[model samples]
Target: MEKNQSLVEENEKLSRGLSEAAGQTAQMLERIILTEQANEKMNAKLEELRKHAACKVDLQKLVETLEDQELKENVEVIRNLQQVITQLSDETVACMAAAIDTAVEPEAQVEISPGSSRSSDAFTTQHALRQAQMSKELVELNKALALKEALAKKMTQNDSQLQPIEFQYQDNIKNLELEVINLQKEKEELVLELQTTKKDVNQAKLSERRRKRLQELEGQIADLKKKLNEQSKLLKLKESTEHTVSKLNQEIRVMKNQRVQLMRQMKEDAERFRQWKQQKDKEVIQLKERDRKRQYELLKLERSFQKQSNVLRRKTEEAAAANKRLKDALQKQREVTEKRKETQSRGMEGTTARVKSWLGNEIEVMVSTEEAKRHLNDLLEDRKILAQDVAQLKEKVESGENPPPKLRRRTFSLAELRGQVSESEDSITKQIESLETEMELRSAQIADLQQKLLDAESEDRPKHRWENIATILEAKCALKYLIGELVSSKIQVSKLESSLKQNKASCADMQKMLFEERNHFAEIETELQAELVRVEQQHQEKVLYLLSQLQQSQMAEKQLEESVSEKEQQLLSILKCQDEELEKMQEVCEQNQQLLRENKIMKQKLNLLQVASRQKSHLPKDTLLSPDSSFEYIPPKPKPSRFKEKFLEQSMDIEDIKYCSEYSVNEPEDSDGDGGDGDDEEWKPTKLVKVSKKNIQ
Candidate 1:
């Protein structure tokens, strides 16, 4: 029992040790698991950041492409504008030459003389028409110039608008820079964390010795269990033997008790006989001794009586002395009480006098109760009057009568009035200030509205000019056959200049848009770069986390390997035990085979005896020896059934089953001997030989 308990304790201790190791391993595994989760999260974030960066890069490229296209358009527009300007300049020069020629022709016509009357009339009229046309063209040119000036003003306003957008972009860039700085700081922090995690991972590495130790411990435990099992089996056998021995011991004890009882009875009989013989002799001696003891006891009693009388005398004398001392003490106590009584009586008399004197002293108050009562009465009377006044006021309010007006107006002195005027002036000043502020706001609003109106007007002016151009085209087409070509040329020059101005304005707007877009793209790039840095830091942290997890997994793997080795050891022990059991089973099988052969021979002899009995009983011997009757009388044999044979044939190879089939057929023939032993043996062997031959064939 002690050994079993000790083994159990050892097992418990080993289990505890194993659990501790498992706990440590589990803790490491959990740490790894947590780190892996963190790594996964970081990976996801990194992927998101990468995706976002990719999207931003794509957008930036698209913006750049757009800007390039806009730049090309602007360049085209500028080129067209320049070409138009040049064309206009050329047309202007031609118009000036035409005007000079017309002026010179008129003078030449006047110089030619009035003798050619028809030529004079035609020249004068044509000259007047040309001058009128020139004047009209000049007016149109002035209008065009004014329109150009307005366009220039609009362009300036557009430039001013672009300035604010540029400022906004600059501010955005500044903010993005600040954000990038913050991201850099964060990245630095993350890097530090990653480094720390990496250090933790490095520090957490499991040593090879620990795993080896665990495996050794597991092997020892398995060995202990096997030993304990063997010991327990031996103990069981010992206990069985001990139990039989204890039974024999109990029977022996019963016989020993009977013998002991007989011996005790004999010893008791001898002791009784001896005690009676000694009692007669002791009685005679005791009588002699009794006489002498009675004499001595009488003397002793007389001496004790004298000693008691002496002690009583001594006690009486001591009691008298004590009584005398007590009497003196009582007298002294009486004397002390009398003196105390006199002093106490004197103190009581003095206390009574002091109490009387204190009672005789009276206190005087300054005010009389009657005066206080009178004051209280006066307050009560006043309260009554106020109550009456309130009642009257309430009644008047209920009757809807207006209360008497409080005349707050007073005749003002010059100083007071001056103060009042100053206050009014201050209020007026404040009002003026507010009005001025409102006017400023209104002016700003009006200016904005005016700018918008100008922009709208500028935008509409081109449509108006185009309409005018259309009108001019119609009019020119109507007069094309009649009008001089100079006027038409002037009109075309104006149209070209208008188109050039329009293109220039459009180019300016496109340039501004491209600038804004570029600024925006730059900000986006900075933001994306910051995000990428953050993602990289996160990725680094994740890598560190993964390393930690890998360390933890390695630790777990070592633990698992130890467990697997332990399991293998356990399996090996089980296999050894199974092998021993198989050996035992094989021995039992050999014995069973011997028993079976004896039973078979006995069965054959019984069959012969039954046949002889049947013949003596006048029954047919064939009937007793028939297969059906034999099967009925005999016990079942250990032969393989048809199903089992078929199953074995299907499961094994054909060659293996061929030999097995011979044995199987012989088992049935042996169980039901169809003839004598020799005949049966010969017949079965022949059949087996034929089957074997067929299998070989």
Candidate 2:
């Protein structure tokens, strides 16, 4: 490179001398020509030409002195430039060698670090400065590098050695032109391939669009199916509610019928009690009337006998008193019978049987007192045994020695079910918080993207101008028909620039949207986390409640089992006692009926005795009075009757049936209702009562 610069310097000096010498020689020749012909025509200009020739020769000699300091500084500046050029040339050679080595070595060895890139940038700057200087030198060399001056110098120094580089440069230029041609052909081939790839992409887009349409249809179908399922579930629940209502109504109707039957039984019992009382009054009255009539007849017979024995007055004085007693008894009998009739008119017949029948069921219910005591004793003994066992069980359970809870392993274990919901809620809450943070980040990203888009738009507006101008120049040059191919190249370049600008814009927009979306997702996650936390808290609360309920349920189950056991024992005892009492009641009722029959037979005998007594009373003395006469007229008053008793028995039997039906039907039903879900079950007493009353009424 230094040699090139020196050669350039030497050539500049030679050109200056040659220019001076030529000027001097031209002036000298002009002077000679003037002296030869135009002496008479160039009278004043002739001397001036001679003077110009003399000055030109002096300038020529001065131009030849190239070894001066001014020239040396110029040389030194050139030398510095030469050194820079030499350094640059050597670096280029080194870079080339390195590149060759990089290609030969593996890919791992030739990495460009940031620092290396910076160094290369500095090198590029130095190269750029040298290139500018070189460009100026090329212009100077082309104008001043004269072969004629070298020829003249060769003539002066006949024995000097010299070689020029002109032929070598001409050969280099031809080779460069050939390389450019090959590169252009390759670029054309690449353009053709790019066009083919674009066609393939267009075809793929059509297929993808078809696939997306199919996916949309499937999604719509799934959504419709889900809606149908929801509707079906709703319909099922509605039907169940209707069924429940119908069952409730039926139960209420049955209860109403039982209530009516009980009321009728109570009315019948009251009627029977009244009738028994009336019958008892009537029977007592009839017995008293019969007794009185019999007493009167006895008195009459005694009086008749006394009359017959009047002749023998001293024989029976006591018979006269007896006759008076019988007459008094006859009057009392009539009074008693009338009183009995009046009492019968007010009250009804015999009611003892009715009262007994109704109360028989009540009293016959003998509590199983002995059995209860026995069972209680057994239970107490068992409790004592259980207490001892409990201590041992407690010890085992304390050390986790009890059998595991009666549960199988499930995704939702009772323990995990108790707490997993809360954990998930907490996790979700944390996620929500993270999402919130992400949302903020997305907002920042969106702002950044927006800024990037603005920047891109600003840069693009001016960039297109350069491309457009280049296109116009190219188009003007080509459309002139001088070079149509050049216009296409220019158009391709312009299109590439537009596409790059559009891609940059799209990239900036996409980046902004993606960043915003990411942040939004973060916010959503944070919100979800918060929701999860809330859900977890709710779940924890529910778990705690459920655990308490489970504990309560366990305790209740224990109580229920104990109660059920007790109930079973009591029920068996009570059933046995009730059966015994029922048998005893039936015996007592049969005995009472037999006694009523006896009373009727006794009344018939009393009636026969009354007729005989009336015969004696017919012959009674004028004024007979005694304490025995009062006793004779006493009659049975109206009172209870067997017919009333029978009616009462029938009523009681009906009432027992009613009571059993009402209790039996209601007990199990109420228990089931109690076991129903607490949320949905409702005993609509008002509705039921109204319906029941309506049916009963």
In angstroms, the error of model 1 at 122 is 99
Clashes of each: 0, 49
Q: Tens digits of per-residue lDDT for model 2 on 1-697?
A: 8997566545444433333333333333335334524532442353344334342343333445666868756555644554554465456445534533433232122121111211212323332233333333322332222222233323323322211222333344344445444544544554444444434677557545544654554555455455545545644654564565455455545543443453344335435544754665576566445435644643563464344335223212232333333334434434543554455333212122222222222222112222223333433343343344345445543553222211222212234333443453454344345434433543443344334334333564445423321234334433443344458769999999999999999999999999999999999999999999999999999999999999999999999999999999899999999999998787656654544454345445544544444444444443223555433343432222433343344333444334433543454355446445451222111101111222211
Clashing pairs in 1: none
How well does each candidate superpose onto the true structure, as a TM-score? 0.12, 0.13
Model 1, runs deviating above 4 Å: 1-431, 434-516, 519-561, 564-697
**Please, what is the whole-model Cα lDDT of each candidate in the order they appear?**
0.46, 0.43
- Residue-level lDDT of model 1, residues 179-253, one tens digit each, is 555655555554455445533444334323334444554565556555555555655655564565455456545
**lDDT for 4 (candidate 1):** 71
